[model samples]
Target: MTLYETIFTRRSVRQYDQVQLEASVLAEIRQAIDNEKQLPGQNARFEIVNADRLKGVAAPHAILAYSAGTDAALANIGYTLQGVDLHLQNSGYGSLWMGMGKPIEQSADYRILLAFGKTSAPLRAGQGDFKRKSATEISNEDNAIARVARLAPSAVNFQPWKLDFSPGKVVVRPDGGGIRKLLTGNLQKIDLGIILKCVELALEREGKAVTALTPKGGGKTFAVEVAFE
Candidate 1:
């Protein structure tokens, strides 16, 4: 399946089968991470933890633990990780981002985890199941991208975000009213990355394209300038 198809078809999987990952599958994942690290402006490092070691460390079944060299490094981390997430989904692996809290450690760097494995059974969660505000609710009637932005995920399913459309841009801002400050720190940034994945995929499926700008300054708000080529 295509990446966009996987976005619509994928659902969060919380359970997994006992089978171990295939050698080829493991290689592909490692290769993808390696390639992403070589991309320009990327400083994040990804390490594949052994499932047994993970269990020993009280980690999830299969994890890609990522850490950035600095705070400014997170934007590149966000973009690259989203690509990794979508690639895994398209390859038929069940994956979810774990962002509630980081495990206590001596390390001072920022960390995010991606868990992957085969689903033990059919996914119990519904795909595209969340209720989204109508186009009129979030933007002008002609704003088609708002429909896709509504599909983005937030911490604990809060969906705390709003979109504003102008002549050629779509602004994404978080609604702090619904977000719990401590429970999710910097997670919303990762969630925004996921939303960007959905919007890009959805727009491409419709034969549309847009330029995504790197988020500037820290706050709940960010913008993606979408213009026709």
Candidate 2:
């Protein structure tokens, strides 16, 4: 399946068949990580490690996703690794993002771990299988990009992004206020990264030239504006 197709059909898998991937497959996964695009100004790293090296998950293999620990690092980690998550599903493997899994002191640099292996959990049959917010709920206009962004996974499914679209650009910012803001502020950035990734993929599929993302005007929360070239 194509990566774009996997975007709609992939599901986060928890139970995995306890078999290690072949060396060639593992090498390909590592190479894919090496080629993943980076969000500007964010430094992220990834390494394949034994599942036992992580404290809270069971899988034949786990990837230690690490970053420079900058303010945008967590969100960037989400942006970077979401591609791998899609790729694994496209490759017929199952993957789950473990936000709470502890890396067994292999390094303090680890930010998140992804557990992946074989599994019998069925691939989601279609886009309809996704239980996500509607496009209207996440954006000003209910367009194709917004439809895809609405399906982006977030911490507890908070889906904390509000999008504004223009003729040649897209601007994304945080959504929610009051207690929800206080509770999900930091996590919302990571959620935005995931949404940004969805937008990028959707735009690319539409033959739009995605430019480098730049920061928007001043606000306590982070915002990004992406222009189509």
Please name the candidate that would achieve the greatest TM-score relative to the true structure: 2
- Backbone clashes for every candidate come to 0, 0
Q: Summing lDDT over every window of 10 consecutive residues in candidate 1, give the lowest-scoring window.
A: 53-62
RMSD per candidate (Å) reads 3.8, 2.0
Candidate 1: where is the Cα deviation over 4 Å?
Answer: 34-40, 55-61, 65-72, 100-106, 123-128, 131-143, 177-179, 220-228
For 1-229, candidate 1 gives per-residue lDDT tens digits of 6665555456566666656777887888888767653223546777665555442232244444465633235545555666676677667677766664244443566467676777644432434465555556655534555665565555676554555556555555544444365566566555555565565656667776565444544554344333432
Against the hidden reference, what TM-scores do the models get? 0.76, 0.91
For model 2, how many clashes? Answer: 0
Off by over 4 Å in 2: 176-185, 216-219
lDDT per residue for candidate 2 within 1-229, as digits (tens), equals 7777788888889898888889999999999888888788877888898776777887789888877655467667778888888898998999988767777786777767788999999999988888888999888899988888787777667777889998899988877567876776556666777788888888888889897777554335667788886
The global C-alpha lDDT for each of the candidates, from Candidate 1 onward, is 0.56, 0.80
Local lDDT at 176 for model 1: 40
